[model samples]
Target: MHPRSLRHRMEKAAKLLVIIQKHTPEVDCLFAPEKGEQGHVVCEFSGSGMSRSNILQLGKDLEARGYQFTRKANPWLGQLSYTGKADEKPTIILSLPVVKDRVAINEDTPATPYSFKEA
Candidate 1:
């Protein structure tokens, strides 16, 4: 890789680390490779430790930090983007799992419009 690109990536990673520590210390974040115009950060919370409200709070916290959020195809997943003076804005892909046994689904329950498919 070019030296300039590597330096830019390092800078971005450093910035993200501080943001994550301050805004979302409860969740685990995996920094993904940059593609095209954006850097990707994948976040998933621990199964037993996380609640739906916690996930919702993360979204709110991110928004408060100046990131705009866009819901993904999955209800539990969404993308948050922040565009500053940086050449490539960071895009956080947050995936929160549905806690098992938390919601009881019955035959009378209506199916969701989204297809729950694996990526």
Candidate 2:
């Protein structure tokens, strides 16, 4: 790589994860989709040690810290199964959108729909 290009790459590499960490801590993170943007984030959390109330409170705390989240649910047509039983593990989906300078809702309407397909 050219010297300038190598430096630019290194600078970005050092900053990229710092930015993500600043925005998204272990509890949760938030971000918004732009026009013509599409992607997804899968977050794995440890709930094996905490009580039910502790887990729920952690979610609430993350929300208060400004993360937008929704419980992951079964697809409209059917639920996904592991082995023979349906996978009922709880998950949270986060999205960040802004209107003007303040944060706004990233809602889908009848005209525009959002869907996810997993393999």
Candidate 3:
């Protein structure tokens, strides 16, 4: 491995640490090598209160800091499981809802869509 590349990776890791520390204290952050991959660093964090907007903003922020973000999908429930990877390395796993549940209106309720036809 080239010394320059190693140094650059170290710098990135340091910067990521600082960013994580500054933005999220309640979240648990982990830095490790990607599974089945070599010469790559993966950052995984898990937290609550994660929404789609929040995740989008987070992605933008990470991208600005030289990290690529991808949102993961939920397998079982088919919902957003809140897991994303940055540069295929820095990954975020959130335990929050990306979409809200549908609210069912009562059948007896008068609230309904109205339609008018020209006479």
| Number of clashing pairs per prediction, in order | 0, 2, 0
* Tens digits of lDDT, candidate 1, 15-104: 766766665677777765454444566676644366656556556555555565544333222322222223355666666553344233
Q: lDDT for every model?
A: 0.52, 0.31, 0.43
* Alpha carbon lDDT at 79, candidate 1: 21
lDDT of 2 by residue, 32-102 (tens): 22211121222233322333344345445444434444332223312221111012211234322212322
TM-score, cand. 3 vs. native: 0.43
Give the poorly placed runs of model 1, Cα more than 4 Å off: 51-54, 73-87, 99-119
How do the residues 1-119 of candidate 3 rate in per-residue lDDT, one tens digit apiece?
A: 56875565556556666665555534555545333222333333334433345445555566565443334444333244333445523344444333433443222222222111110
Q: By lDDT, rank the candidates, best first.
A: 1, 3, 2
TM-score of each: 0.57, 0.27, 0.43
lDDT of 3 at 26: 46
Model 3 residue runs over 4 Å out of place are: 1-10, 34-56, 77-119
lDDT of 1 at 60: 59
